[model samples]
Target: MSDHVMACIDGSGHAMAVCDYAAWISQRLDAPLTFLHVLDNHPPPDEGNLSGNIGLGSREHLLEELAMLDERRAKLAQEQGRVMLEAARERAIGDGIAEPHVRQRNGELVETLSELESETRLLVLGKRGESAHLASEHLGSNLERVARALHRPILMVPETFSAPERVAIAFDGSKTMRKAIETLAASPLFERIACHVVMVGADVADLRSQSDWAVDTLNNAGFEAHGAVRNGDVETTLHDYCREHAIDLLVMGAYGHSRIRRLLVGSTTTAMLRSADIPLLLLR
Candidate 1:
């Protein structure tokens, strides 16, 4: 992997917010930032199917015109993608990224990201893209697929941007959660930020012990950490805690232990991704 941060943005209301979050991560990691806008290459259906009841002669003429229209639309899409990329690049530069790289590629977003994974260690994008903006229940089409296809860390930025001051780790006593804790503790990403370790479950005593252990693990690594044990299931508990406490960032393992294999096969990660209003830093 190239170790650069890849920020994917379509021309949705979330595009600028994605840029802001990407710029924040790039500056914090001191890594190069690359802005990508994928020109959707999925072709439209044939004119025959589209032109329902037109006569044969008119249909042939319409088919030729439709072909020309397809070409024209493709050209326009490419041009529009370039403009979006240029605007993102300029915004990143203004946000202190010295040389934000910009590229307009043609492909499905997930397929492109999988192909580019070798050079990318971190991927950033808006939680909801252009297509799903109208439906509150629908997730960004590319989010889940990209998360499933690649093992790299993904930062899903919401529609608005905010500088994170308090970061929380949704800790569970699992190997994956342990790895996420160690990684977050060692990285500069959470340095100087208040780290809150929250665990969701009814086993009060066990949960406290686990939270303490995780918090101590982080504190020993030089982070100012606090621990809390919440009562409820993972999704509702963690979400409510973050909201009530004004948490700016939520970090967690993409998948937990086999029983709770969120990203690998479970729906918890997807559920959280759909509802999480703040930025999420997901590790696999």
Candidate 2:
């Protein structure tokens, strides 16, 4: 597997937080860091729409001018992406990375990331993107798509970042959660951080056993691990736990539930991404 951390950059409020968090992860894992800015190639709404009829000569002239406009727009977007990538690189260096790589591509963000997934160890991006309203509860349009398409772990940062001191994992003893636990044990990303394994459901003996096993696995791996079972809705309970414990980061499996179930009810992953103030590390 590759060992580089890739931070997605854009002209959003969360860009700086993405850089800082990426740098923090790179330093922790002693991995290379990269800053990526992708210029979306989708044309503007008015690109080829011509209103009203006109003479052939006039129509041809208008078409030429519209082509020129499109070219200019593409060029401007490319330049803007370059500037964003450069700024992200500088921020990463300032955050203690000696050297960070930068790349700008012209394509959809999710497709671009999928093509470069092989070279990525961890993917970091904002929960929201440049086009998203800062005050809106909606997540970045591409956040869930990227998570669903990629197999690598993704660290979704908020609009602000702080070095994580307390980490919580919403464990449910599923295969996905078990994989998350194994990854945490094997990876040095959270070394020595206080870890809480939180499970929400009926307080049954089997659930307690699973939580204990998770806590023990993490504890043996040199983490300050603790286990707790809470009773309530999964998303609300997790949020409350994080707030009450002052958790700096939340870790969990991404979209572990089936699509049908999520559609019928809702997805905890989506809910957390939508509302969590702290950063999230989602494992697939």
Candidate 3:
């Protein structure tokens, strides 16, 4: 993996938070920082408006005008993307990153990330972006797609920045949770942060054993780790645990027990992302 931390910014309310989070990670891991702003190639699906039936000559003229308009819009979009990227870099520098790299690409978010995914150590992004923020029914489309496409760890920040003191992980004794445990243990991101491992399931189930194993593994890996068992649904229990314990950051595996990309985010994960106010470090 590359030593650079990649932070995606779209000048939305969450962009600043992304920069701050990326700076924190860069400082903690002693890595360089790169800011990326992607300008999608196609127009918004809602923007295609057609005029009433017109003569062939009129239609040709209208099409030409539309092409020109599209060209101008593309130019403006590229310029705006550059400005946004520059501002993001400045913010990252202001947060103590000495010199952050800025890049503007023209493509879908996942496409850009696919090209550069292997070139970054960590990916930092906002929970929502410009167009998708108002839609409460669905999470950020690009965010969901990127999470499904990459195996790298993604740090999803909220609109506001708060330095995390403690991190809680939701463990379900599946391979997904194990991947999170193993990856987090070897990373420096949570070095000084307290680790809280909790499992939510029947009291008599094997959850306790898995929770115990997770705690021991984390402890052995040098984390200030402790495990607890909560009796309730996974999402509700995690939300309450984080709130009551004042966990600053929440970590968990995405789409637990399913490696299929189509399963993207299970109900529990979706609910947690939508309701939890803390930063979520989602592992693939």
Candidate 4:
């Protein structure tokens, strides 16, 4: 299986945070590091329709000019991506990575990532992209798409970076979440960090049992771990738990529940991504 850590770099406020977190994870896992940038050069739909409104001779000339302009833009975008990748590479090296790879591709973000998914053990991405200003209330437009398309673990960073000392796992007791706990136990990313396995539901026997199981798994793996059963909404309760515990990072099973359930009761994964200020490590 591939064991490289891939960090997606773009012109966003979260880019620096992404780089730092990726470097941190790479060092912890002792895995190869790669910085990826995708150039989205699809022309606007209206551009093609504009030619019909002009005279034949002028229209042909305008089309030619438009084509040339598109080509220029694509080249510029590639250059910009190259520069960004180079900077990320330097940052990774400064963070103790011996060697970092840089890759630039031209295509849609999700598609490109899906194509390279097999080579990625972990993916680090920003919470927002270049269009952050346009949608401050929402997560990065491509985040959900990419998360759904790839089956690997993903670390989504906010606009700032801080090495985590305390990490909380939002447990739900499903097989999906249980698998996530096992995966976390096998990884070094959260080694030696304080871990809290928090479940939001009635303080029932089953809930406590599941929580204990998760804590035991982590403890066996050498983590400073504990478990808690809270009563409230999943997202709100998890956020409150993190804040109250001064948690630095949140771990969760991304979209672990069924789509029908998510539709009936909004997705906790999406809600957390939209509201949580701390970085999230999503296991799939």
Number of clashing pairs per prediction, in order: 2, 0, 0, 0
TM-scores of the candidates in the order shown: 0.91, 0.92, 0.89, 0.92
For residues 165-265, write the lDDT of model 1, one tens digit per residue.
Answer: 99988887877788888888888887899999988877678778888889999999999999888777788888888988899999877754466365442
Q: What is the overall TM-score of model 1 with all chains considered together?
A: 0.91
Mind giving the per-residue lDDT tens digits that candidate 4 earns over 1-284? 38889999998888888899999999999999999999875544653334345565575668777677767767777898899999999998998999999999888889999999999999999988885555655877689777767889988888899999999998888787899899889988888899999999999999999999999999999999999999987888998899899999998877644678556333777887788789988877
Q: Tell me, what's the RMSD of every candidate?
A: 2.7, 2.5, 2.8, 2.3
Local error of candidate 2 at 190, Å? Answer: 0.7
Q: Distance from true position, residue 150, model 3, in Å? A: 1.5
Position 209, candidate 1: lDDT: 84
Cα lDDT of all candidates, in order? 0.83, 0.87, 0.82, 0.85
- Better by lDDT, candidate 4 or 1: 4
Q: Candidate 3: lDDT of 136?
A: 43
Residues 1-284, candidate 3: write the lDDT tens digits. 57778999886888889989999999988899999988887657564323333346676778777777667777887899888888888888788888899988888889889899879788998888888856544478787678768777788888899999999998877777897798788888889789999888787658788898899888998999989998987778898999889999999876544456335446667777777678998887
Candidate 1: segments with Cα more than 4 A from true spot: 43-60, 256-265
State how far residue 39 of model 4 sits from its true place (Å).
Answer: 1.0
Worst 10 residues of 2 by lDDT: 46-55
Q: Tell me the lDDT of candidate 4.
A: 0.85
